[model samples]
Target: MDLQKRFDKLKKLGLCDRCLGRQFARLGYGLQNYERGAILKESKEIHKNIFSQENIPQDISPKDDCFLCRGFFNKLDKYEKMVIAALTNYEFNNLLIGTRFPQNIKDKEKEIWEVCGDQYIEPIKTEFNRLLGKRVLKRLDVTVEFNNPDITVLVDLTKDKVELQISSVFIYGQYNKYSRNLPQTEWRYKNQYSESIQEIVQAPFVEASKAKEGKFHGAGREDIDVRCFGKREFVLELVAPKKRSIALKKLQKQVNMIQDKVEIFNLDFTVKDKKKELKGKRANKIYRALAVLSKGIEEKDFKKLKQIVGTIKQDTPQRVSHKRAKLTRKREIYKIDYDKLTSKKIDLTIKAEAGAYIKELISGDEGRTRPSVSQILGCEAKCKRLDVLDIEK
Candidate 1:
């Protein structure tokens, strides 16, 4: 049917601006259906005025009702103001607006579409998002980002109500814990430090780097009892960061001063583009573990075990079987060196693949692990102190 015929049918059903423009949603870019419908409605009015002398019958009435959007289109200004108020404290460049309507609203939209044979009506979410997004861009001077946006502004338009969603910041960096007894991330308690690892790392970055919040991501995590002696590869994803190109060396120094136990290395700016590659990259790690023999053992026994350092074997540690499915894994021992800390204690240095269980390798886990320190020496061995020595890309 012609636009006039469609308009006439819609007007009989009492359509709102948001609902009216939604019928031709695909025809425009950067404008809401309500605005589009209103423009078309005005054009029809003008045309009617120009041809009023011809005595042609008008098909559609001036007032219209939209089955899909109801009258919500006229309330765009109110929704925009609410969004602006919600975003007062946040600083962001790119944003995405997501609209959520109540189940009843969505059902009404769907019912309208079904009755109209799903011909021209746009989704309620699309219309709301477009209108609100345009208003926000105009007022805030911020661009809309579809992929990896700095902020995600969510609008929930359900039962004449609106809600907003704020996106989080992502920061990428490597951190090394130099001492034990410090949690890898943050320690939270009701009376004690309730802050997360991200909170601790974000403060300095926000101040020194002038960025937003920071999210800490590491290749793997170590136990709270284990200390990271070398570089622990990580990426601190900063969410909606106001600044980039941070002075990593200086930031490292400052972070260390705050907590001498934690050290950051290989700090650099990473964009959303590189996140996939960063997550996929594999790196090697070295660890130094203080091993304690359950019984007295000869120095010659330790030397004999070093002979099999380069061998690869299957290992399955029992301690982690609960979280991890039982599976045989091939791991290689690249290098091994030991220093006699005492007659019953020794410091063992090991270079292995990224996922090798260093503590398990020393303890043997009751023979569940092969080529382990306990199995090698024919004496039960246990790890007293574990530390990551190095991380290499």
Candidate 2:
């Protein structure tokens, strides 16, 4: 159908300026639909279609009589007020506005599309969001963020209700755990330790943002008995945060100063994708372990410790078998350095692939770990103390 002929048909349907202009919305740039409709009403096509030389058809219809929108656009002000009132207790920097029209409104628009051919028309929902967004920006002194809005206001014209969805705030950083008793994240301590590295880092963020809860994401985790001197990447997510921002540097300093178990640095605002990336990332690690041997370490056996390199075949240790799958894992041992601390003990430094169990490597996990430190020394060995020295960049 020709655009002019379609316009004549829509004109007879008693559409207001916005509804009529929306039918030809794609034809013009930098013009509102209402303005476009008004402009088209004076065009030569309108002169030929519905009016004689001396008579013209009604160019604009009253709100209540518009067959397409049925005065829906007129209530944008009411919806905007409802949105503003719903946002009274929240704090945000930017927002996105959306609308849900009644089924009848959708049906009316579909009926128009069947006749108008819909090739160059803008959706009523699209126009509603844009107009309401502009109104909100002007009134609230805030900007509109389409990709990642801090708050999303949903207006339901059918119910005449407004609802809000507040997005979670993500913070990225690295943490160092100094206490050997603390777990990497919150878990049952078995009455071992009441605190955790995650709790220490997330308390300040949850408190400052007034969030309902906080979740922790780490690049990898360290065992409860192993202190991590190397910085481990992590992301803290605050759900339903009332406020969007807090002083990053100040908060980092506060956590570092107050927490004896864990300290954080390089704290900065981040996106949701960073959390997924951090969780998937893997890095090599270095560790120092004190292995207590069942017998005295001979000089020949000590030299064999240097040969603890290349691929290692290990099964899940008995200690963590309940949580971890029972299967063999192959990991690379990059390097090993050892010193004879006493007749029955040795200080061993190891660099290996991530996910390799250092405690099992030293003790051999009752022969679950093949060619480990105990197997090399020809005796039973157990790690008494362990510490992470570095993580590969």
TM-score of each: 0.70, 0.89
lDDT of 1 by residue, 50-138 (tens): 22222323353324445455556657788899888877766677678887777877887677655544555578777668768998898
List pairs with backbone clashes in candidate 2.
Answer: none
Compared with the true structure, all predictions reach lDDT values of: 0.67, 0.84
TM-score of 1: 0.70
Candidate 2, residue 257: how far the Cα is off, in Å? 2.3
The superposed Cα distance between candidate 2 and the true structure at residue 185, in angstroms, equals: 1.9
Model number with the top lDDT: 2
lDDT of 2 by residue, 1-393 (tens): 876688778778777777877887776566667766666666647422332322323444434327667777888788788888999888998998999988888888998899768878898888888898899888999998889999999998888899889999999999888887888777656367677787889998899999998889999899888888888899999999987768889989999888688879789899999999988888999999999999997787799987679999899889999998999999999999988889799988999998999999998988899879999998989999999989886
Per model, how many backbone clashes are there? 22, 0
The global Cα lDDT (0 to 1) of model 1 is 0.67
